[model samples]
Target: MVKCFETGAYVLNGREIVKDDAEAQAKLASMLGQSADKEAAKQGTMAYGVIQAHNHAEQGGLLKLKFDSLTAHDITYVGIIQTARASGMEKFPMPFVMTNCHNSLCAVGGTINEDDHKFALSAAQKYGGIYVPTNLAVIHSYNREMMAKPGNMILGSDSHTRYGALGTMAIGEGGGELAKQLLGKTYDLAKPEVIAVYLTGKPQPGVGPQDVALQIIGNVYNNGYVKNKVMEFIGDGIQNLSVDYRNGIDVMTTETTCLSSIWETDDQVKEYFLIHGREGDYKTLKPEAVAYYDGLVYVDLSAIKPTIAMPFHPSNIYTIEEFKANAAEIINYIEVEGRKQFDVPNLDINLRSKLRNGAFMVDQGIIAGCSGGTFENLTDAADIMRGGSTGNGTFTMSVYPGSQPINIELVRNGAMETFMSAGVIVREAFCGPCFGAGDTPANQEFSIRHATRNFPNREGSKPTDGQISYVALMDARSIAATAINGGKLTAATEIDVNFTRPKYTFNKSIYDFRVFNGIGKETPETELLMGPNIKDWPAMPNLTEDILLKVITYITDPVTTTDELIPSGETSSYRSNPIRLAEFTLGRKDPQFVPNAKVLQKLEVAREHGENPVELDASLAAIYDKIKSIDPEKVVDPKEIGIGSAVFANMPGDGSAREQAASCQKVLGTWANFAKQYATKRYRSNLINWGMLPFEVSGDPVFDKDDYVYIPNIRSAVLSGQPEIPAYVIGDEVKAFTVKLGSLSKEEREVIAAGCLINYYKVK
Candidate 1:
């Protein structure tokens, strides 16, 4: 189990935790004072040191960094390069890597995924970038194997771009940020507070890294303990974990809504660097003797049991023992939550029916992706599943290696054969299972996976289409145990198994033969292959003087994830084309969103040509009449106004760091989002990059669907850095409300003024 301490905790070399600042100073004086160390406690953390090394500007305050490397998968790289090219990029300014994994399946749209891969390969040659071809490796795994350097920061388009345990500080952001890096623009952000994740005790034999990670995520996610900050790991339990175990734990830190992560480096980390053929990248990293943290998460690894995160989120967790003992109660709760998430009436997930003879059962089990497909987890899973059968029933199992290198080792070490003997389908390196592209269960089937998420339709069942399934995330060890138990849910600790640790040999030839590494070697004449589905972005107008937004969907969900805004599964193939992808905007959460926004967008499009034919509903006319009644002599001109739609969510932008969540909203004529608070920095950045006003409401609003909200002089207010804007909601009665446009960098403000990142760079 994990415990979160309130802000201002001091940890000393994995031993003692002192809450009193004066006593902590006394303890630090006892250690560092004797040595006459002059380093400030705030700057002594591994996270601070790493960020400081990469920050090329002034050595204090805000960060304007230039990352040493950048990465994007197929779902992102195409759009990023397109935007960079549109923004006058000649060649990649730094090391840019594009991997084809998310859209590698090519099962949905014929030739669309392969066309993207081909375009990426050609783009890499033309832009002096590196390319990992289809099924070679996932984005994060490839970067960890080749590009992660100690004390260097790497920015990626995918959200899980963390490599802290490998002695590198990596961040996952929207494609707009990566495009800025490609154009040699500095990444601007305020210096974030660092939280200490103090690990103690050792995990028991059957427990895996995912179990420990889920425990940490569950404790931090709901309470906002580490939101938009860095988590710096320093503790004695680091001595017990392998490099892979640390990596498994580190990658999932993104789920905690942290900005980035770092860990104290040890010999295992050094060996990891050496194994990846980057011995020079290995360096000892730790917090200084007098390091200070704004907050602390104390995790006793020994007490953590095999855990499972129930449907819809990673934070809804329970130990495997606790879940089985209360399956009926848990199922009832989950089924109720599912009805809200899916919006399907009478859609019940029957987990209790699977309980036969006092044992809970599942239809399928999966062990794949970066968290589950690592060498340690799979090897341990193979041990648990050895000499066992999955049985001839509805239950099935699939395992995917994280990379070709890991896949080679598994096959060479006979673990692959052992898993196959147990009727497990071992596949190539693909991220389909993690995001809903492959191995989707049947309707109403319950699947236990060790992938990154278990959100609604994350396994590919369409609830709106009367097909709803469930995915509960568990550790690979327990997943393997369940597979061997003939689909009955079983924790790994309940099974007696001994693992034969195998040494892995890294092979570079697999990548050399198939992968394209064209860094520093640009072929300018190369032509990019374009599929019919691949299209350029539509032109967007700048922010108008007066703006009008209609509240289309008023969502009351506490935390609306990016997946809910724009789904991940089949819609991923349409990301390259903004217009096509916009159709899926809020398709999962609010089915009527696109039509409503599209209707309002036509008015704005018509006004762009100075042809303002008044086409207003009676409700809209009442708002315009109210404005006219206020100042009839000035005359509110339609030519000077812009019409768009907006949404009101309690809290939005949680899960994935996909920019499409915001971009699709922009393309659909969404001008603003009213939320209590954003879930992550990446989501807010996405909104800013897409030119939407991220409005934070102070109190209850009198806004409803089809109601007009008018903001006068919005463009001037944005350019002048006005935090609060006077907005009026037009309903039966004209009521006014205030919306705060939180913190924004100068460049972010300019991006909003210029309409979007693409337009901002176009004019610059």
Candidate 2:
């Protein structure tokens, strides 16, 4: 279904693909008046134009990016503001907005949810920040209406911080990166590879934007095709999609693992901005003719079909038609994987129970969040659900508009009434169910959703404690079809429903009245309120000349996500309390990880206080004796070698922009993470901020639990500013390996030597 080009090719004249050859060069010269290959020889990749523009904006130094405005939803903003306060922020340096969408329900924590909302309002008044009260909008929806500007850079704290379809280069990252922006620090990175997402053709009837997005995600996610690169959308297909349709596909680009995305803008996008009352912000963005791309993802939109991602991941995709043909085999695969979550003996993988009279079955349907909560998707879902009951057996359906404005539009257009007449519940905008904060299912129940992800525990299940549920990703149309069939998974193509593409009339009065906007103002006398639960970060130790670490938690998976490292739901409440949150580090993934890590931490504490490490932990004495027997003269001062813990994962730091993944380990006395590869740029930045060594190991070694790996001259190497360090894994056999620090800035190198980024800044 997909094909990849071997060498980088350019999309010439918007229809033909030209390989880097002479005939292609002659054709390019005839068409564009000059040869692109010759021009590329003079200048580097065609992608360099965008990079140079960004570079020149900061005068060729690191761009100290100050976002024009900022918006964050409930699940993230509280911790972001709290971290900024801890780092001595007097007021918001720029326009910062806090919206209460994720935790609006307030089910888990009592008054804490409302308390955070009130706190945000008060902070907006005391300091110079904006507060969008509860139920106003989802984060990205509000950003699209009010914040996005052409050729502008926006940084958000959520993972789906993409507004590329609206002509904005936005990036989502951890709260620490936002905190640095508040403290006036620059975002540093080497230039990234740029991939051209050349689009052509047009989608046939019935295929939605989710279909196109899933097609792209399935192609690029597995092989690291566009990992940590920039995806520049271009070509004639830009004219084929509407603004909302483009937004639907653009938001899911985070799943491709690209650093950020940008797209060519047109009159459709200009109309979108104009309707939202920001016509002045619209600007046409197009790549220079004969632009060079490091790689190209040529997408024929007409070929994309209605698709579904089975349980566990968004990338595990298959066409809905293909899946229906091989139902038994697919169910068997799910059954085998489902065993990892439950101990149900002789579990029936037969969703065939809902396949009454030859139709596949599902238990629930949801159309919500950035992907499905848009005005068009909701209206289409309402039309599908109109006058149709979801039936009483196992089927249920719910719909959440992306924002309050969208809800108002639905009500005005009578779409909300149509959905209510069909017994479909209309919910306020919230990201809860998408990330496991709400809509928990009964054990073994299967749900289909239009939300962003379907990771394990993402549907509000705790598999470790034995409560399990599964989620499958589908478009709103398929979800509605499944609901119509009383829990049977039916493709939308099999059902007849008329979709009305309603015109959107944005109401800016609601924002003007309810939302607080503060920009270019300073409030020096403002005092920050601190709740008892909010605490300062724990002190961290600097790097030592020699280091020893015990393997505390080891997983051999090909990739370990941030969700697995820190979890999502209940743990969010403790995000501001580092030490308290660290108590839950690996609690779900490995129950013994915290206790084991804490034991090693205590020994390091004892050694720091001039006590013998052997007295605190007698087990280390045996290892020390063996080391002494090997070389007595190599024995150094106890303080020179710091004792800590490490974990080994094949690839760590995927999914979510949560810094707690790395910070929790630092608070638990983890000095290093040995992984085959790091998943995202944000997670690697988190490790540097916490002073944890993100080490990479190649090949299979016999490194097991409780194995000791020794790194000699670690501190001197960091202080001496060497990029590469040699270390020995001391266990059953002596093995030598190399650990690279990648490219570290002067400040980043100092941060590693000082044991933590905060410590380095504080001492300096």
Which candidate has the highest TM-score of all? 1
Model 1 lDDT per residue over 1-764, tens place? 68887657655554567664545656656755642232456777888888777786776656889999999998998889888898899999888989888998787777888888888888998988998888899888898899887788999998999999987889999999999999999888998889999999999999999999999999999889899899999889899998899999999999999999998888888888788778887889888766778889999999999999988799999999999899888888887776776666666666667778888889999988888888888999999999999998989999989999999899899999999999999988888988889999998788999889887778988777778888999999999999988898999999999988899778878888987778889988888777787888788888998888889998877788888899999889887888988999988788999999988888888878885626544345556777675556866976678988999888898878799999999888898999989988888999998899999986666787778898888998998989888988766676888888988888999999999999999899
**What RMSD does each model have against the real structure?**
1.8, 2.7
TM-score of every model versus the real structure: 0.97, 0.94
lDDT of 2 by residue, 554-654 (tens): 88766777888988877666665678788878765777889999899998988777788877767776666555544578865555578999998888888
Candidate 2 residue 119 Cα shift, in angstroms, is 3.7
In order of listing, the candidates' clash counts read 0, 7
Q: What is the lDDT of residue 664 in candidate 2?
A: 91
For candidate 1, the lDDT comes to 0.86
The lDDT of each candidate is: 0.86, 0.77
